[model samples]
Target: MNEYKIEDLLFEELILMDQEASDYEDLITQIGELAFEKGYVDKEFSKAVIEREKLYPTGLPTNKVKVAIPHAMVRDNVKKSAIIISKLKKPVLFKEMGSSTDSFIPVDIVFLLAVNGSKDQLTILQKLVGMFSDDDAMVKLNDMKTASDTIGVLKEILSQ
Candidate 1:
């Protein structure tokens, strides 16, 4: 596996307050704005995010934990990027990607992913999946309350 730097693999701009009125559109706008501020995406990044969300819902079914993986296509707006993990106090409902059923997935942890390429993106996602799969890592991640704390945990995990 290709090793990534802590700064390169994680986005700190994920720290935000999303209200109950905030839908997927609002979430995408917030993430897109952060991506733009970080110079990882263009001004039109929100459009790409919405398009990607429409096609592939990034809601993962977590039996043991509460997490969501929200990603988008990298062709238009993304340059260099990482996963922006946000811990929400309340669960948000998202439709499952490629599924027709009315099943809505409730998620507390959101991983807003911005990638430069399709193949490279999957690799990053796999790394995160592996990291989160570790019982110890999940515990450490969930225990974190602040952005700095979360970033510290992510840095430690990536370094390992």
Candidate 2:
């Protein structure tokens, strides 16, 4: 796995807290565009992420909050191994991970990953999954008031 510091992958400009979107696609596209402008991903990154989400849903129904991890594996499009943390203003419908298409959940947060390496993707995903499974952590994340504050807490949790 590629060794990376959590802080390095996180950008203040990429963090979206209390954002409103019509749906998952809109949400992903909005964030993707921001990342692309910042040189973190290519132009096709958002479309690819939407297509990937359609085939393999990434939503997780945790104890306190429901979250989604949306990403694509187009290595060339990923300029850097970065993460966009978006806390939606209202919940959006998302098909649950590993579940049937009809099995949908309302996702309050979206973790949009743009990782260039497969190993790095899996490593960051594992850390995120562990964090999501923790009820206290989920609640804290859901209640976080500021993006920078949330980033600090995430760095502390995911750095391990």
How large is the C-alpha RMSD of every model relative to the true structure? Answer: 2.6, 1.3
Worst 10 residues of 1 by lDDT: 12-21
Per-residue CA lDDT of model 2 for 80-112, tens digit only, reads: 779998998899888899996578889998999
TM-score of candidate 1 to 2 decimals: 0.82
- Over all chains combined, what TM-score does candidate 2 have? 0.95
- Whole-model Cα lDDT per candidate? 0.70, 0.87
Q: Report the error of model 1 at residue 68, Å.
A: 2.0
Off by over 4 Å in 1: 1-7, 17-21
Candidate 1, 1-160: lDDT as tens digits: 3555435766556654332426666766777787788787788877877787778887767655556677766556777766666676667777765578866777667777777767767777777777767777877877787787888887788667
